[model samples]
Target: MKSFDVAIIGSGPSGASAAFELSKSGISTVIIEKETLPRYKTCGGGLVFRGLKMMPFDISSVVEKEFYAIDTYFSQKHPCITTRRKEPIVSMVMRDAFDNLIVEKARNNGVTLLQNHKVVDITFGETQTIHTTEGDVTAKFIIAADGALSPIAKIAGWKETRTIIPALEYEVEVPAADFERLSNDARFDIDAIPYGYGWCFPKKNHLSIGVAVVIKTNKKINLKEYYAAYLKRLGITEILKEEGHGFVIPVAPRTDFFVQKNVFLTGDSAGLADPLVAEGISNSILSGIQAAEAIIESQLDPEKAAVLYTEKLKTGILPEIEKAKVLSYHFYSKKSFRNIILMKYGQYAAEALTDLFMGERTYPKDYLKSITKKIKDAIFF
Candidate 1:
């Protein structure tokens, strides 16, 4: 059995970031991943400015597209508002390429990378033992970055209250002639659907379109139907690919406690995803850094480590997630959303919402009010 200072489970952004930070701190860290390197992950492929800034290394090579404009529609109307940023606020990249880039950077920083290793069980004691497909390994601390459906958390006896929203996305090859019409202003569109919203993000050669809706009343809706309706609205008759990929985005609030004994939970495993936008990358990366900081601090004072970890998470990440819970409920509610749109905050709402999403501003009540006042001023004056 190999022994280390830290054992991080999963190689997504959270795991890689944690390992990178730990190794940079001169701690012996090993990152265990179930899949091979550069594995494909289903995502909307949107990375906001805040998330890009949190990366430990440069990611210019993997960026697929940069967006400066935002188009938001309440229902198809004459005055579909547009908001433009001076610089690109969002960049699109394939998940496989983005995640692999971080993992490679972690390895370069001296973190041992164990690929194709699935952690079957974890035993916590004075020293933690992680049993994996590769072999048994012991470490002083364990970090779980295994995502929303984390088996590690379950095995470790941590209860998670999950409110999962199902998302379906497809990549379509748009004909050259139709490119201009499909991407008029290089802005992504958010169509307010029945229970959720549909998004259209333009890529280099393809259009990434998707819909997300909450599962309600123990009922299952056909994701295919929702995706097809989005395409039909865009006047797309033929799809190059007949099928699309599906994934789950957790909209739940953060868990009660992020650390217990010798174990720490970061990223989706701790339900750090933004509730309003269903975005996880930014929070994942931020939480991963926080986890590493806690681990390093704990090495100095093991008695106060868990308390400090919880405090940092509460102050840094949980507050934003709490606000997102309220905002998500407001946006997801049909009546509230309609009232909000009627108030004319739709144009810059997405960008403002993205700002809050990236933890740049927690709860943009003031910004929303300013937007509402601006709209009122324009209408009267």
Candidate 2:
């Protein structure tokens, strides 16, 4: 078995970010990926500005579209809110290219890349030994960033109650004329459907259109049906290419155990996804960096490292996720009220809501009170 200072499983954004951060600190690191380079991942491929700021390197090369406006619709007929941001709020990119770019950066930074290697089993003793398809490898520390269904997390006996949000996304090519007319100036639109919402994220040549709905509900609405309806609403008929893919996004935070002995879990494996938007990429990257930092700190002082990891989650990420869960419950429970609030508040509220969604600001009790006031004002006024 090959031994190293750190062993990272999975090559997604989280894993790659951890590998890069550790390797750059001169720690011997190895990354094991289950798939080949440039693997396709089922995702909406949207990157918020705050997420981009957390990366160690520049990613301008991988950005597909820079959107500064958001158009939200409560129903298919009318727009609820149209907000123009002063700065670039979000960027859209294909996951294959985006993840591959980060992995390549990690390789360039001297992290050993074990491509096409799947980690089957992991044993923690004096050191950690991971059994992979290629071979077994040993490391002083192991970081599990293998996503929602993380095997490493399972082996470590980390308990998680994941709220899976089923999403079906597609990339469809529209005629040049229609694309030009229908597409706003680098803006993304969100249309609230019966069970969930539909979104349109424009790329270089095609549009990333999708719908997401909560799986726990009894509403068995087909996403493709919504997609067709969305297209018809937009007056988009001609399509060059269309491909639909579905993936599960965890909405709630994991219970408690994200770290065990010599193992640490980051990203979706720890259920760090944003509950309000179901966005995981930024949170995954942030958690990975935090995990790497915790590992390094733990190496210096083991007890302090463990304490710091827990503290980081409690003070850093968990609070935001907790607030998001409440917001998500509110949206899904009383969607009409949420829609009316968006319509009445318009862009200022949208921007603040966007900040809340991106985890840039904490949701205070007063903010919720203000929302209630707004609802009352809308009713009375």
Candidate 3:
């Protein structure tokens, strides 16, 4: 068995990032990935500016497109709001290349990359033994950076407490004119689906389009029907090539403990996706870095690292998600009232969202109080 100080599962942004940080600090790290490098990942591929800025090295090589403005559309009654910025608001990329780039960086820094190694089971002990199909590898700590359906989390005695929402995405290619027309700007259509929103993210060659319902309901929502309607709304007459993928997004954190024994959970494994937008890349990278830092700061003391990691999450990631939950509820649940508020102050809200995307702002600590005040002011004054 090969032994290391830390073993990280998955090769997405979270795992790659943790490996990169840990290897930079001279910690023995191994990234155990089930697939080969540059495997296609199902996602919108819209990397917000905030997440883009988290990259330590330049990723221009893999970036497909960068948009300086974002167009948001609601019902026809409410006008579309365009938010602009000096810097690009969102940069698009295919996840296969983007994720592989990060993992390569870590590998260059001496992190072992174990491709085609699927973790089938985990044996907990002083040194955790990760049993993969290929073989067994041991480590002092295990960082589960695997995605929403994290088997490691379940093996570590965690229950399903995260709010998992369904989403459908398609990689679509159209005529030159349609691609050129829609490729210039990133767009979002709120209320495109019941309790959800739609996004059209232009890539280098095709358009990555999708719709996701934030809040789960008892009603059976047909995403395909809505997707077809959305395509018509976009004026898309012909589709040269289209591939659809269905996946789930974990928008809330698990109520269970983050660390058990020496195994630590990060990113989707810990259910750290942004509650409002379902954007997990930024927080995934952040949580990965935080976990690495906690381990480093504690000098490899598992107990101390666990406490420090939880503290770091509470201070930053958790609170932001909580506030985002409040915002998402208000924005999606009360549709009529939300439209009213947007009709009055849509531009400001769009600008605020752009600022957040640019990493210049954060979700306010007391979002409910602020929202109430705004509602009162909007209604009376």
Highest TM-score: give the candidate number: 3
In model 3, how large is the Cα lDDT of residue 30?
Answer: 98
lDDT of 2 at 214: 42
Candidate 3 has an lDDT of 0.91
- Which candidate has the highest lDDT of all? 3
Candidate 3 residue 179 Cα shift, in angstroms, is: 0.7
Provide TM-scores for the models: 0.89, 0.92, 0.98
lDDT of each: 0.76, 0.78, 0.91
**Which runs of model 1 end up more than 4 angstroms from their true locations?**
183-192, 214-219, 300-303, 340-343, 348-351, 357-360, 365-381
- Clash pairs detected, candidate 1: none
Worst 10 residues of 3 by lDDT: 366-375
What digit string (tens of lDDT, one per residue) describes model 2 on residues 236-261?
A: 88888899887778777778667776
Tens digit per residue, CA lDDT, model 1, 8-49: 998888888888888788999999989998998878788877
Predicted candidate 3 versus true structure: per-residue lDDT over 1-381, tens digit per residue: 899999999999999999999998999999999999989999998888898888999999999999999999966578889999988899998999999999999999999999999999999988999999999999999999999999999898888999999999999999999999999899999888888899999999999999999876788999999999999988899999999999999998989789997888999899898887888998899999999999999999999999999999999899888888888988888888787777678998889888888889998777678767777888898
Model 3: how far is 369 from its true place, Å? 3.5
Candidate 1 vs. true structure, TM-score: 0.89
How high a TM-score does candidate 2 get?
0.92
